[model samples]
Target: MYLQHFALTQLPFSLTPNTAFYVGLAPHQQAFEVLQTALAAGEGFIKISGEVGTGKTLLCRKLLHTAPAHWRLAYLPDPALSPMELRWALAAELGLQYSGNIDQQQLHQLLQRHLLLLAARELQVILVIDEAQALPDETLEALRLLTNLETEQRKLLQVVLFAQPELDLRLAKHQFRQLRQRISFSYRLRPMTVAEVAAYVQTRLSIAGNPQLRFSPFALNRLASGSRGIPRLVNVLAHKAMMLAYGRGQQQISWWHVRAAAKDTEDVQAEPAFIWLSAALMVVVIFGMLFWQWGPL
Candidate 1:
């Protein structure tokens, strides 16, 4: 809605993980490097765990975009399926033709054969499962079994799991220990730092065709604090602030706009009083420093 008002071609703060708006910040960059190194090494299981709204999906999409051309990728955005369904999904991804009436054993055989064929062609098959914490225990085990389909040198099917922090807790349980142990590389994505938040906002705006425009410095600070450095929250607050500024016919987003927008967000509303208190403290500190430096009695 604020696109035209902001002289932009598209929404800058959309929740969807648009790779076009991807900011290669430290956390995300490191995650990318880890993924690249792990996949290149032919690691069996790779896991990336992040808090909700920490850009796990975005990172996933970025990885897909940058993966080598020779790699065959299968993405599973939903992991609610049973083991049989999981096998069928993998089979479908690998372009295996099978009758619907086929049983579990047939499905497994078909998947194995397909993996072997892909490996023979010197192609790396990667199965990326998002929301992996939602997968049933049986399904996870089934995935582990799938990784067993390997050649003498390396794994045939590499699995990269992207999930919320709960997935780590799930993996901690004794029931999932076997599957967890197979993870050769894992990265925990952290929330953006305040500096990172500022950079992230600017990066998104620039990508949306607003390279010269920016959130005011104070507004950027407020947004970073209010968003608690979560990219999703930052996007939510920034987008709302932009819309509010547009409605007011203002060109610049101010701290007040960010505060109002933060109030409307569920996760960010927990520290309303603290936010104002912090703002007041900052003002007092600035005034005191100025008085000490330049006051005359």
Candidate 2:
């Protein structure tokens, strides 16, 4: 609704993880480098863990797009499958079609054959699993076994797990010792800093074809504090603040817009100290304007 008012071609703060709007924040960039280096080394298991809204999916998409030509990527966005289901999913990714009446043993044989064929062709098959915390214990073991199809040089199937921190806790258990031992590279994603948050907002706006609309320093501070530098919350608050500014016919976003936005967002925590200080400053400004105009208390 504010596209024309703000001179933007697209909405900048959408929650969907779009690579076009990606800003290589320090943590994401570091994670990207680690993934690339690990994959190049033919690591059997690699893990990337972060909190809920720290841009894991975006980084996954970035890796997919930038992977080398010889790389074959199979992405599993949902991981709540049983062991048999996991095999079937991997088989489908490998383009191995069979009758529904085939038994689990037969399916596994076919899948292994296909992976061997791909390895012969010099194709590096990478299975990237998002939301990996939901993977069951049996399914995790099945995935590990698939990586056991290696020749003397490198693994036939490599796995990159993009998950929340809960996945780390799961892997720390005794049942997951094998999978943990196979992990050659792991990274923990960090939240953005205040400066990174500001840069993130501007980057999105610029991608959406920003012309003149801008956020005030007060608004940026409130957003960074309220969102705690989380990218998803920053996007939610920023979108709401832009809507408020447009509704008020204002050219710039101020602390009032951000304050109202934070109150509306469920996950955002209000920062009361700065809120009271801003209120006091507003009152002093109002009093000064009144005294200059009509003289008096």
Candidate 3:
């Protein structure tokens, strides 16, 4: 509804993990580089871990989108499969045709033969699993066994796991030692910084065709602080702030709009009773800083 008011052609802050709106912030960029390098080096297993809403899914999609031509990618967005189901899913992703009543051993043979065929054709097969933290223990072990399907030169299937931080805790157990050992490279995504959050908002706005629609310094600072520099929270606050501005028929987002948005959002970590008073004080402080930074904004 606010798209026309904000001169935006698309929703800039939608929660979906769309690669077109991906921001190459420091953490995401470094993680991408690490994944590319590790995959290029023919590592059998790699992992990218982040807190929820830290863009792991977005980065995973970006990696899949830019994967090398020699690599065939199989994506598993849900990891709640049993060992047998996991095998079937992998077989399906690899386009292996098999009977519905196929036994586990038969399914495994079919998958291994398909992988061998791909390897013979000089193509590397990659399985990228998202939400890997939810994978059952036996399923994870099955994945490790998949990596063991290698020739003398290179692995038949490389796996890149994109999961939340809980995946690391799961891997710390003695039961997962073999799977953990196979992870040749790993990257942890960090939350964005305050400045990075500001730039992120601007970048998305530019992508949505409205670079001129600006968030005031005070509002942006409140957004950055309340969101704790997390991209998803920032998006939520920004979208709500813009809606407030649209309601008031205002062109630029202000501190009051951000304060109201933060007060309404459960993720903003604001004390319910102190929102208005804190906003008043923060406005004074923010204006003072703004004046000092820009010589009377």
Candidate 4:
């Protein structure tokens, strides 16, 4: 809706984990580097945890895109499946054909044979699981057993988990110790800093075909504050603010629009005093313009 008003070619703040909007800020870049290094070194298990809306899925997609050609990737976006279902899913990803009557032992043997075949071709198998915190204990234990498929010289399969902070708490349980211990490399994704948020907004706007147009400095500050430096929240507020500005036929988003959008957002609330200040500032600007146009000579 705001695209036509702002001269933007596309919606810049979509919540989809689009790699095109990826900002490569410090934390995300560091996590990418760690993932690349661990995967290259053939680490059996690697964990990356972050708060909700901290770009875990984006990073997961990025890893899929950037992984080396020698690596075969199996992505498990839903971990709600039972242990047997998990095996079937993995087998399917590896292109293993199976009959519905196949038992658990038969499935395991099929997966093992497929993995060995891939290994013989000098291909490394990598399993990536998202929302790993929801994985049932039995499923997690089953994953641990899968990781056990390896040669005497090295592991045949590497597993990478992307999850929210709750995964850490889950892993702290004694039952998960074995899985935790196998994680040779791990990274925690953090939210953007205020400065990073500003840059992130500008970068997205520029990518959307608006290099000169921008949120005013005050508006940017308010957005960063209200979003708590979270990139997803920043995107939401900024997108809403742009829509508000478009509704009023404005090119630059002012602090007033940002404050209003923040109030409208369920997760964000601006101080009443600040809202009054924004209104006062708008009045002053309007008065200043009128005085310059028609004041006493």
lDDT of 3 by residue, 126-147 (tens): 9999999999988899889988
lDDT of 1 at 258: 91
Better candidate number, 2 or 4, judged by lDDT: 2
TM-score of 1: 0.92
| lDDT (Cα, tens digit) per residue for candidate 1, span 25-90 | 999999989999999999999999999899999989988888787899999999999999999888
lDDT to native, each model: 0.90, 0.91, 0.91, 0.89
Q: Candidate 1 at residue 162, lDDT? A: 96
Point out where model 3 deviates above 4 Å.
Answer: 271-297
Give the root-mean-square deviation of each candidate in angstroms.
3.3, 3.1, 5.3, 4.6
The residue-by-residue lDDT of candidate 4 on 1-297, one tens digit each, is 978778889888998988888888899999999999998888899999998888899999998887778989999999988999999999888888889998999998889989999999999999999999989999999999999999987798999999999989989999899998999999999878878888889998888888888889989889888887777888788888888898899999998898888988877645558767998999999999989999954
Off by over 4 Å in 2: 274-297
Q: After superposing candidate 4, which stretches have Cα over 4 Å from the reference?
A: 269-297
lDDT of 3: 0.91
Compute the lDDT of residue 219 as modeled in candidate 2: 90
For candidate 1, give the lDDT of residue 172.
Answer: 94
